[model samples]
Target: MNRPHYILQPVSPLFITLSLTGAFMLNLLPWGRWIGAPDFVALVLVFWGIHQPRKVGIGIAFFMGLMMDVHDSTLLGENALAYTMLSYLAIMIHRRVLWFPVMTQAVHVFPLLVFTQAIQVLVRFIVSGRFPGWLHFIESFVAIALWPAITWLLLAPQRRAVDRDHTRPI
Candidate 1:
């Protein structure tokens, strides 16, 4: 079955802010320390970075990372560094990634998410000399699984209606 191609409307900056804030709130929930807990912020960051690189680029990602760092009480620049790198990489390949189907985009995203997690783990390991175990990487896989749903949700606001009413001027 073929999917309908949408001519997406221009994304509102307010919607982007709200979505990022919502992701941050989700990250603040108590389940964050669980073995496979997905990183909502990271997911949202990647989404915006890929879809709206001009509006949500490395600076925004770095800011979000600093917020995460403060929340997690880890090293000051750990998440900032990771997210900055993630955003940079995402922006670098945003055009290429956007050409693929959602599933293929998720495949492309998986490595980016893994790389972010790896950076964090590497930082922590250097600081504390301890490994958090292989399960730490599961979070990236979980995030990848949510990619399609997230894409649908985030893009919903920008998608033009499938049934256009000819009488009305948009």
Candidate 2:
């Protein structure tokens, strides 16, 4: 139950499109410390990077992050910077990392999230002259723990694509 596997397939562009939209919705949802955590954008990005590397990449991540930054009004390029780093990691590791069990890659990806956020924090600190609350880092923990399940949900399209033998070369 702790481990995850990437069974590659072609997923509907519709699902991918919806997933991207859903991520933004989730990102915008208001939440307290006791409820859900940060946006699942990176989680979706990671799954696509592993399962559909050709479809989702740094450009998408950067754009999504940029949108998020604009939506949240945090600083220009803050989320974009973090998202770009996450995208870079996913693309770079997609080939070999895809072979690893889902949980294994999640473990590795946890730091990429943290590191990216760390950069975001550093940049924020430089501009704002203060740090975000400790709970802000909590998103990393939530992301790693939630990776497998989120990955599973996005896998639907992959399976649908594969079922129809529409897998494109990654």
Candidate 3:
């Protein structure tokens, strides 16, 4: 794939730090299986995958998952593999995905997270012969419901990005 001028674009130091920190916090949020929700890291990966694929892709996902593994103490490779695969798929579909409206994107986003989580489930099953119960779907559901809000929150800084770009007169 042809690369965009992203490196030349010069993203904000604040946004980079905040987005990664937010991903970590979201992953750390405590929740039960009461309602189905999508994986927050997966959601963030998709968000960045579509909006800032160059800045956050497989490398980010792999490393983030590794961090998560270190904290969660699950199989080291399990989350890493799931995150990398999900990031790859999000980028592969990024172009086509950007065309959809936020609500429509959420519709598909639900399944995307499901697919990612399914990979995790499959891995767990093969490795341990068991998977998290029905409760885990709550993560995907919550991810879809929050998609619009999350996108806006993250992308809200974008208008400022243009302002930031124009200030220095490149």
Candidate 4:
């Protein structure tokens, strides 16, 4: 099967901010406490890191992570550390990740999401000496499942129209 390649337009900083904010808002919902609840912030951070590394780098991830730490009331800097590392790794692999289709990209992303959660769990275990159990890792799987849809949604604003009008001259 052949896929039409789209020449994406330049991404707006405002859109990036909005998407990150929206993901943060999604995390604030009541269902966040449930097991296997996907980390929206992590997902979006990775997305932007992979697609626009210069625009969304370690600093942004760290800030978002700090926000999550405050919200969760967990050990300070826990999320920040995880997000920072995640962003770094994403940025390092961004070029290679972009060559794949969205579905394949999800395959590449699964490890990153799992690593993020593992860092959180490791921090919690070190601080409290309690394990959250294997179920905690399910969130990564859920986030991976959402990867393709999120890719489409986030890229929609940057995608140029497929049809060209003859009245317009290049």
lDDT of each: 0.95, 0.76, 0.77, 0.95
Using lDDT as the measure, name the better of candidate 3 and candidate 4: 4
* Local accuracy of candidate 3 as per-residue lDDT tens digits, 1-170: 34232223445757866887787886677752246634677788888887778888899899988987886778888888888988888888888877778888888667778888888889889989987887776788778889999887887665344445545533
Worst 10 residues of 2 by lDDT: 161-170
lDDT of 3: 0.77
Provide TM-scores for the models.
Answer: 0.94, 0.82, 0.81, 0.95
Per-residue lDDT tens digits of candidate 4, residues 1-170? 57877778899999999999999999999999998899999999999999999999999999999999999999999999999999999999999999999999999999999999999999999999999999999999999999999999999988855567778442
Q: Between the candidate structures 3 and 4, which one is better when assessed by TM-score?
A: 4
Off by over 4 Å in 1: 162-170
lDDT of 1 by residue, 21-66 (tens): 9999999999998989999999999999999999999999999999
- Candidate ranking (TM-score, best to worst): 4, 1, 2, 3
Q: Model 2, range 21-88, lDDT digits (tens) per residue?
A: 88888777776234338557777776676666778888888999898888878899998888888888
Model 3 lDDT-worst window of ten: 1-10
Stronger candidate by TM-score (1 vs 3): 1
Cα error, candidate 4, residue 21 (Å): 0.3
Model 4 clash pairs are: none
